[model samples]
Target: MEKVFKVLIFTDLDGSLLHRDTFKFDEIKDYLKLLISKGIFIIPCTSKTEREILEFNHELGLNLPFICENGAAISGLELLNIDLPKELILSREKDDLLNIFKNKVPINLQNKCKWVFEMDKKKQSLVFGLEDKKLKMALNRKYTIPFIFEGTKNDRNELSRIIKKDNLYLQEGGRVINLTDRVSKAKALRIFVRFFKKNNKNVKTIAVGDNYNDLDMLKTTDFPCLVFNDKFTLDEIPIDNLITTNKPSPEGWADVIKMALVKIDKN
Candidate 1:
């Protein structure tokens, strides 16, 4: 007997799903609802903070896990899971890391640039601050980090250097370096997949994103959807199972999902 497969859609928010500036995408709501009706899981994976994701979850009425802070944290409902896997704290002593950040590149923030920075305060992860236009602009830039990290190779090297040997994985997201001694997007997703495999009647995994930062999760899934646009520098790697949206941002994302599901049905 062949088992039916279910689908999991891990969508990136910034350039992948929403419009660059305004985070409004209504055209895709119906498609999302249709997927939900068919028992498909839609997970919004992003470099956004928990608070940022919460707002989206609220608006979309989605209760699935969200990848926030560049996979540094994966949360659902009331339970918050950190990739670090350590005793969660506000901040930690990262004199070496801090020094590297200071010397390599200026934080590139301005007075007007607002942000809710998540940093280690006493070995715990903490989030604080208001939004700033400067920070917003920095996040919108191609690379959010100090060094020239633009691809999987560059990112892998930098991750090895900046983090302690014990703390291997790191996420350079939005405008912050999510440093963790523990897990990664791909790893966390494996866990999520296990849960789905056991609970769901059928399961499928779909990953969507538009930047270098999304490389891990995109590679992890069976389907990697690239939200094509001019701003993002995507990999030229040949992955046969990819869904390139017809339109960038809201419209494109909507079209890709609906169209992919249609194609899935056809085949």
Candidate 2:
């Protein structure tokens, strides 16, 4: 394969690319598509389910590869290379993770978690800030369980520590907390990079995100971009060349991305 510079964009969706509340990106739709047309990959590295990510791809009218379920799986890799798999499972099944939590996590800690899937459709929609097909798709999680942690800060810290003992971890996204195996966006990104770099020698990653779930991924990329997330403090996830934008997502996404590309070109 010819070795031309390749930029792989690993972006979170909520609070990063899509509007945090509305889940729309119409403002940057053309910009995203334009980047794709120019051969830049806009890969969603999000805590969302595969079905929800597919809806995103469908809306974009593009068949882009995505890292889903907080990196529980990587799908659409066949788009990158002929020999690569159509889907790669990176974490254990959702039930297995849930079983561990049920048996291991203390009853008090468990009670503090309101599992999203166990909720009625109406409540699920309310917690996720999604409705109709989008809500349905979001619930189709295969490798992770989404839930709301109704615990105090100290209780949450204790729960995080306990889960790590069993090799289960939490991914706190913009909307909810996800329980899963010892998988993360960074691990999935590394796997994708390893597979993609096999034939393609020139690959520079640009990671965009807005929440705790996306921190490690941001650190791993050539250019890291954080969309305006006032709730998150930047000092905690600091890294060199960390690009940021003042506006919120749907617009901040495009802004930081453009900044990253300019830096990529200059490098």
Candidate 3:
């Protein structure tokens, strides 16, 4: 490719671009302002909800594109042109998932772990208490719904088969299988890139993340950076065109990314 002034930096939120929690790094605001001043667009791609994305965007004073629900939705930039819904993993009603694993899945999994649980006993379906880490691990591997099961060794194959047969899309994530009938981040990015290319054909694509969920987006970008955050093991995964950080969180990320972008431009 070619060096250019226009660039799109897509980053994951937790364990990649920010602290483990929602806390912002002290220098993040300044770094973001610097990038904005340079005319480089910074977009957040996260597994969070639309409402959460909107709130953060408002806080950051950015009217840029947002990839929410783990790449299920993409919007904001005029040239981005992609927004897809995620599979609707219903959280209310008698969780068929709970009943499906009644024999082996622990009943106290909810109490013992830091994962989101489905509480469908009320009139509406809703997800509750997703801050637990242990539960997040369990649900990350195998998530089940009334009609689908994911996270086995043959998860992709099974999901593909289900999609062919039932016209459904399976869910995949860092800490849980969402079981949504929506689109994946990789697929969504392609859509965005097509539109982005239509306007700025010379723009450089940069992606930063810290988990398995980010693999697709990382592969799709021109430059892929892995934030050396504590929550993830960056060395365990293999990727091409990756930039590892000396520090963690967005503060560390900001320091390195700024330097790298400057170096790339200098050369």
Candidate 4:
């Protein structure tokens, strides 16, 4: 007989799980709890800082491990008392990455982009569409530096080229662009999947996202979901098993998860 596989759902936050503007998951709170009760592990794989992801974990009462800073770091295994093969961190430290950005990026390009941390509370609130308190939490970076590019497309491309020369990269999310070390959500997911399958030979992974940064993670999962993002649409991903939700999240998030759960049960 074939062994039954445990299911793990890895999700992006900004425009995939939380409402892009409000940043609330109230609409799908119950469904989330239902998945947890059904023994599905919901891991938030996001560009969000450790502080922000912790806040969400506390709010949702999820003790599972999480991927933070666009796969720069992973934590919470100690909470679950699970020892892994190795540390799950993939990117350089936040300050180190920032130092590289500050040194490598040209003064001209630096002036063209508004570094998020340089902005005051009011300006951050306006740019991020978050309240003062939430913006404070969002700025707690330990790996990635989030920013808004105020330059033209050509300028942004040029800036990216310069950053790449130093082995760094930019990831454009739903609301902001971020600079970080050579790490990606997909790389972190692969590490976690290996650890998970060590305990359970049969395991299935699900990934959901709604933006360019999420492309790699979405492609890496057995079940891939493309949530609707009004801000940007993803190009066609060459996954044989892919699902696109009808509406944007948190509605789309709930819908896709429900569909995945049903399919998992049937299988």
After superposition on all C-alphas, the RMSD of every candidate to the true structure, in Å, is 8.2, 1.8, 7.8, 2.0
2 or 3: which has the higher lDDT?
2
Q: Rate the local accuracy (lDDT) of all candidates.
A: 0.58, 0.91, 0.59, 0.84
Give the per-residue lDDT digits (tens) of candidate 1, residues 130-224: 24542343233211222223346654565457544444345555433444435456665666666555545566677887776777788898777
User: In model 2, which residue pairs have backbone atoms overlapping below 3 Å?
Assistant: none
- Which TM-score value belongs to model 2? 0.96
Assess every candidate by TM-score: 0.66, 0.96, 0.67, 0.92
| Model 2: per-residue Cα lDDT at residue 47 | 91
Cα deviation in Å at residue 176, candidate 3? 2.7
Local accuracy of candidate 3 as per-residue lDDT tens digits, 168-237: 3445444445544345565666666666677677777778877777887888877788777565675665
Model 2, 87-118: lDDT tens per residue? 99989999888998889888989999999999
Which tens-of-lDDT digit does each residue in 102-162 have in candidate 4? 8988898889878888888888888778886677888888788888988999998999999
Best by lDDT: 2
Best by TM-score: 2
Regarding lDDT, does 2 or 4 come out ahead? 2
TM-score of 4: 0.92
Better of 1 and 2 by TM-score: 2
The residue ranges of model 4 lying beyond 4 angstroms of the native Cα positions read: 79-81, 85-87, 236-238, 265-267
